[model samples]
Target chain A: MNFIDFIQAITEYDFLQKALVTSVMVGIICGVIGCFIILRGMSLMGDAISHAVLPGVAISYLLGINFFIGAVATGLLTALGIGFVSQNSRIKNDTAIGILFTSAFALGIILISFLRSSSDLYHILFGNVLAVRPSDMWMTLVIGIIVLGAIYLFYKELLVTSFDPTMAAAYGLSTRLVHYLLMTMLTLVTVASLQTVGIILVVAMLITPAATAYLLTNRLSRMIFLSAGFGTLSSIIGLYFSFTYNLSSGASIVLVATALFALVFIFSPRHGLLRKWKSPKKELTT
Target chain B: MYAVEVEGLSVSYFETTALEQLSARFTMGQLVGIIGPNGAGKSTFIKAIMGLIPSEATTITLLGLSAKEARTRVAYVPQRSTIDWDFPIRVLDAVLIGCYPKLGLFKRPRKQHRQLAMSCLERVGMQDYANRQIGELSGGQQQRVFLARALAQEAELLLLDEPFVGVDAGSERVIIDLLRTLRDEGKTIVVVHHDLSKAADYFDTLLLLNRRMIAVGSPADVLHAKTIEGAYGNPLAFLQKVEVSS
Candidate 1:
């Protein structure tokens, strides 16, 4: 549907208004943090940590606390547990993260089953963006601002560390410090976006835009800006379609990101699938 | 004080001892060469000096200060084969990474950092291809990009591992000339090299290693026939048959 119809629909209902505003703010935060996740080679970890946040939220609900605070606490706990356990001079990072995230997710499932609010377990399992409160919208906005400020302040070092950890080491930037700080920031973003997009789609929120943008550019500065734009556009379009058709907002947002990924993957100039094939053009030139 | 000093250093990879109880020291402003057979500690010593290797050796200190402090003065270029070539990065941008330390965390590089990076690229005669992707460049050009990064660091001490191993002779000459100029400008340079033939002409000091310090001195003192035989082993037997038959 067109913008006019979408705005008309949003005005007609409180739920639509809440979903549209919340998803957009959450999208920008995930876009910025997801850039870091993609560059740092931690897309898998991003998925694991976001999934792990569910149990924390469920427990928070049980204890009558803010669900977002619970998710943030659990996310930080998971990220730290992964970082700390992997540093055990023996266990690799993947195993620790794998074990931690799975157990936490299992606990989250159990808690959700027992609590079973009127909305049903799957409501939180797959996010219900339309049910977001005004506080969630404000929290997402604050997260977006913080993520932007952090990226802007540490632009040079983050870029270098992502590309060359060894060189960054010689320059006196501690890899371990950057690694943990980034994980913490990632946790913050993951938890903040959970209400709008749900656990299952958060990875796509943080990774697809950045990974797709990577195909279209090599410069770091351009990569950040383009990925943010792609993410915001995905949220807006996805929100509109969900508003018109009454589809699941979480799945719709992810579908939008996946669509962008498909477009970039097939047609991107540098490393796209279509360009990678047909070396016949090279044969002709050579 | 010496620029670098290592005493009874040892490093192992899995079950293999790459460097075994090697000891050495070098004064300031010397152009040094580290030469050995394929399995010897030539590259290992460089890694050890750069603290890239996880080892229980004595210690590596650059200048008189601790290794971390001396880092601003010391830079390293790993073997050309060590990098992932397919990583999407531009030559100019890659070289500019050297300035990251000075800029620190959460800070954008100002005008001075850019000008420094450009000057380093100019010194290596790579000013024209600054915008090219690193993977698009030839082996020599890749090495030049690495060299430009080290130069951009403005390091007083440089440890380079196999800078010219697989590149063309022209690129090798360019590297040699650039290194010599760097040394002339009062920087200490050490390289891990495999070609024993040019050991005498290329460096002011020679260090021959085979899991240990086999020899260390001026090339005139260390490049004797016996030392070369000890380092090369009996590999010349196959080459001798080809020489005779041809």
Candidate 2:
């Protein structure tokens, strides 16, 4: 289908409109939160939390409850568990994340296998944005508002904590509290993106656009703005491609983000590789 | 009022004790230096006092208040190496972080706060570098930026850990002069220093520490050869340098 055909479909179908709006919101929020995650060097934690929520989603499905409740619960539990193990023992944080997320993901797979109604299981692993329910769209909207509001109200705390924990602590800001709050926000964003990008690829949405913006700017505020723009653009274009080509919506979105990252990686004026390669001596001097 | 007061303070890692049963007092309007050799728990002592690390202390007071209660009233400049310079923050913004404690939660820095931060940067001679990314500055410039940040706090007590290490000579002079001026203004200043040769010249009171307080008194009293030898556990060449300088 052409651009006109896609626009026509968006206008004609209610589910199409919901999918568009939900994906765009997910894109924007993920981009904003991803800036902090990448800046804190917590990209791996983002991936881990996204995957760990799978068990919660599966359990929620089995219990016939809202997936949002269960997903957030398990996501927070895994985040706290990782923090506890890493802090209380000799094991490093990355190792703890690796061990816990895989276990949680495996448990989710096992639990999902037992349920006779397996049609939704595939959609859980790989998102089906076309099938986004009205409730799921509203849930995404709420999560977006809360996440964005929390960030706005607590930007200073988050900035100081992310930049220098010792300074934050010295000034009576609780770095641990800020960390747990970010983790909670991350889990919420992950759950919101579940129907849009799926559990397996939500982290990409959380990391790629932010990283792309990171390469282009040296200011946190600008980086966040740019990342959100990139994410939104990617979602709109990815949705268009998915509709036209009959492709996986989640994969298409992630690929569009990746493509943007690649472009920025090669062509960003200040930090791009092409600039360095073109003038190696000048780059070294600077 | 005393600037700092501690009794029976002990700090330890999992299996190793960093400092033990340390007791000391610092008066307001005095410049104090914590002098020790490597592994002498100097940084740990600062962290414990700042409530950045866990410790056991029978009594720890700052500016006549409990350590935790007085945190907002104290400004700290940690070791230069402790921060990630590569963070995406401008020099001015980094200094503006000092205004955060006073701004409280959910409140952004107003024009007055920004002006205060800028004036602090001007005091440290970093006004021109305000727009530069933190990583783009020299080590001395970065140190000055941190000092500017500490200055922006506008606190009664200032705690600095090894502010002179890796610093250029000019920056060192600028920092020491700034610190002395702050001290003269009735602010209590505490610095963790390792350079014994400069100890006598820099501090009004010297604290020689080696897992414990070996001496805490005037520089002339604490820089004695025996006191230096005891704290370092050896006759460091700096001991001879310090003796000759004294």
Candidate 3:
């Protein structure tokens, strides 16, 4: 369809409208906080929390509650449990996250099958942004505001804690508090985005912009803003592409972020592969 | 008054006692050096005092408060092992982490904070490298960055874990001068030091520990052959022979 036709279709169709707005909000949330996760080497934490929420949502659905609430609950429990368990179990953070996530996912699969709502589970995994109701949209916005505020109120702490928790702890900043808070935010953001982007694609949104921005900047503040901007831009462009090609908008947004990352990885002036690969003579001459 | 006081402090790994009932006190304006055999709780003593390790109650305290409460007043310059130097932050940014507790969240650094951090860097002779990524710096340069960070903290007490390892003599001289200057400014500095030869030259007090407090007093008294032998649990003759033969 043409641009005018596409705009008309988005305006006329509730599903398209929901997808667009939710995508932007998710973009903003993921973009800012993704920088935190990437800096802390907790990209896998996002994956872990997402899968861990499955069992909660499945059980809640079996009991007939709000799927999002169940997800948020499950995600927080898993995140906090992993946080405390990792400390006592002698397993590395990522390894603990891996173990917890897989178990939660397995339990979720079993529960969903038992509940006779595996199709709904499929929606949570692959997502159906088109089906987001007005209330769910509101929930996504609330979580977005929360994610944004948490990042803002805790920016300095998050920056230091993410890069060096030991120093943050030494500064009396309660590095553990910041860690748990970030996990809680991740829980909310993952649950909010689950309806629009699915579990697998959430990792892409949460990681791509930050990873791309890391290649281009050394300053933490710059990385956060640039990642957010890149995330929004990629979401919009990807939405347009998906609309035109009749593809999955969620996957399209992820692809756009991936494509941007590839470009930045090559062309970013600060630490780009090409820039680093330049010979010493070439650099000196330039 | 003691700037730092540790009593019956102990730390351990799964099967190792890094520190055992180690106790010491650091007074204001005192430069103290800690020397012991490897795995003899040199770094662990510092970590326990900094509350970086899980320790028993009443183990470590600073300025009469618990370590957590007094953390801001007690700056830590951790060993190179504790930092991932490959992180993509500039020297200035890394140094500025020292002032993070003061800055808190939701606020960026102001001119005063930057000035303090830059001044710290200047004291370490690394003012020009404020914008350079930390990973690009040499070992000495990295140590300077940590020194800059400690200086930026403006703490009453500074705890360092191996501040002189891998640094050249020139950088080492600069660090020693800075430490002396900080002491003159009425700060207490405790360093987990190697190099037994420089003990007298660098510090006013010496703490010789081998998983316990072997000696604690003026370097002249604590650096005696008997004290060294006691701390190492070996004869001074053997140590001297090893030193000369090397």
Candidate 4:
């Protein structure tokens, strides 16, 4: 199918429209939340939480309930568990994340094996946005609103806490509370994106666009806007290519984001590789 | 009135005691310097007072209110190294964080807050660099931006931990001058300083600590040879050199 054909299909098919809207929403919230993740050096946590949601998804499938509730439950449990282990023991945060996520992922695999008749496992693992149901679409939309709304309402708290938690504490802000809040939001975003990008590729969606935006801008607000724009564009373009060439939707979207990241990596004016080579002297003069 | 009052304050980390039975009071409108040898719990003292760390204190008050209640009336300037200078934020926006306590939750900065932040930046002579990224500034300039942020907090009591370390002499001069100015404005200012040579010139009162409070008095009284030797563990050769130069 060509670009024209893709557009025509989107207008004709409800499933295509749902896929487009859901993927785009996932793209946006992931970008926004990913900014905080990267800024706080919690990219690994994002990956861990995304993977840990699998057990929840599996359990939700087994219970014949909405996967959103199950995924979120497991995701949040993993996040809190990671925080607990790291905070209480000598083991570091990354180590805790490594231990918990793998265990949860393994349990998820075991649970899914028991539900052999649910052939959508491959779709869940690799994403099949073309098969997104209306419920999933609405879930993504609701998650998008909550995530964005929370961010907008608490931008100041988030900014201060991320940049300097010590200062935030001095001013009577609970850094730990803000951290947990971000973690809850991360779990929500992860669950919402499962239908569009799948469990395996959701982390790439979370980190890449924000990191690309990081290389381009010097301000958090600008970085967030730029990241959301990049994520949304990647989703749209990736969907177009996926529909046109029979490619995996999640892989195509992740590849597009990676390509955008590479472009910014080489050509970003401030921290770019190409700029470093082009004008070392210009930097000294400036 | 006392700006800060602490009684029976003790802080320990695991097995080691950082501060032992410390009781002290800082009066209002004084520029006080906490001078201590290494491992004297200078930073720990500040952190404890700000409630940044766990400690045991029989009573701790700021501006006649409990530490928790008076947090809104207090401003803190943490060590420069504690902050991630590479954070993607502009100078002006960073200063705006000082206004967050007043804004409470769910409200963004308004026009007046921006004006206040800009004026605070101007006070620190960083108005020209308002739009500059934080990572782009020099150590002193960055420190000044932090100071501007504390100023924007509009607090009655200011607590600073080592605002002068790794700073250029010019920046040091600006900071000391600004602290003096703030002191003159009837705000109580406390600084954790490393350089003993500048302590006499910088602070109205000097606190000498070595895991315990050695002395707290006017610089003339606290700079005594015996007191200095007691806190610093056998007056080093530099003490003589400094004494000779003076």
DockQ of each: 0.42, 0.58, 0.43, 0.61
Off by over 4 Å in 4: A116-118, A281-286, B237-246
- Model 4 C-alpha lDDT per residue in residues B1-246, reported as the tens digit of each score: 699898989999878999999988989999999998888999999999888899999988899998899999999999988888778999999999999999999888999999999999988899999999988888899999999999999999999999998788888889999999999999999999878888888999988888889898899988878888888877663276477647
Residue A119 in candidate 2 has what lDDT? 69
Any idea how many clashes model 2 has?
0
Per-residue CA lDDT of candidate 1, range A1-286, in tens? 7889888888898877777777887777787778778877798899888888888888888999977778878887888888889876478988898899999899988888888764656766677787788887778778778878877787776776787777777667787777777777777787677777778888888998888788888776777777887888888888887767888888888899889989999998887888888542342110
lDDT by residue (tens digit), candidate 1, B120-206: 999888989888878777888889889999998889999898898778777788899999999999999998887776777899999
Model 3 / residue B17 / CA error / Å: 1.8
Give the DockQ ranking, best first: 4, 2, 3, 1
Score residue B135 of candidate 1 by CA lDDT.
Answer: 73
Candidates in order have lDDT scores of: 0.80, 0.91, 0.82, 0.90
Candidates' TM-scores? 0.90, 0.96, 0.91, 0.96
lDDT of 2 by residue, A1-286 (tens): 7899899999999999999999999999999999999989999999999998988988888899988888999999999999999999999999999999999999988887886357677888889999999999999999999999999999999999999888888888889899999999999999999899999999999999999999988899999999999999899999999888989999999999999999999999977999979977332111
Candidate of highest lDDT: 2
Candidate 4: true contacts recovered, fraction: 0.80
Q: Give the TM-score of candidate 3.
A: 0.91
Docking class of 4: medium
